[model samples]
Target: ADGYDSGGSDEREFADAWLMRAHGHNAVDLDEIDAAEDALQETQFLLDDFAGLIDDFESQGGSARDLFEIVRQVVNNKKTEAGETN
Candidate 1:
């Protein structure tokens, strides 16, 4: 592409940083790499749904904070179901 660095080093660095932050380390086995890829894919799927919901809600004049509160409540309810406190 006809972009910034021309060598794409910047894009590689950004991807490396993102992957490191997501998986916590660069030294991992093949299985771990597979697991991380699976987890990331699943998270992307969830984020697509979450983003859609946020867009729909905002389109209706709803506050993003309200969506966050709903997520918090869901987390708390799950914890309660699992006998977790606080």
Candidate 2:
């Protein structure tokens, strides 16, 4: 019954998930990993800035920040494991 019904959540989720996978696959490649991390950081910043505006988005759209947080945590976990193995 709101803007989310327009497929915003699905689309954003899809994009974030796809990019997260791409980053994970290339995590060992410093350049790709750094670029992906930077993009994730930017996404988080935007979500934080518009936290209030989300309410205006109808059905209360979810924050991309949450999605980004998951990706970051996952990446860091892998990084930690790599460090431990080294």
Candidate 3:
């Protein structure tokens, strides 16, 4: 979903709805907003790391590339799973 072959669609939709409702009521919760922003920032950093790992793998041609991708996918999948439960 969300342009990625990976998961997390349900989590994304729920969060978006929560934010919209909070904004509509003019009662935004700073803690929740901060937590969401933090999660996004953390995920972005993980993605940046993945990009760097890919570049390094391309240049070095090592065996770890597959392992790295697998790890990334697993982490992302977990995030999607957690999001769905919320």
Model 2 score (lDDT): 0.75
lDDT of 3 by residue, 4-64 (tens): 4425789778877989887868776899999999999999999999888878877787667
In candidate 3, which residue ranges exceed 4 Å CA deviation?
Answer: 1-25, 62-86
Could you tell me which residue pairs clash in candidate 3? none
Per-candidate alpha-carbon RMSD to the true structure: 14.7, 23.0, 20.1
On residues 1-86, what C-alpha lDDT tens digit does candidate 1 reach at each position?
Answer: 55544358897898878888988664558998899999999999999999998999999999999889998999999999999999
Candidates' C-alpha lDDT: 0.89, 0.75, 0.82
Candidates in order, TM-scores: namely: 0.47, 0.30, 0.43
What local lDDT score does residue 26 receive in model 1, on the 0 to 100 scale?
48
Tens-digit lDDT string for candidate 2 (1-86): 66554467888888878898888675567798899999999999998877656555434666657756877888889989888532
- What's the residue-level lDDT of 22 in candidate 1? 88
Off by over 4 Å in 1: 1-29, 77-83
Best by TM-score: 1
Better of 1 and 3 by TM-score: 1
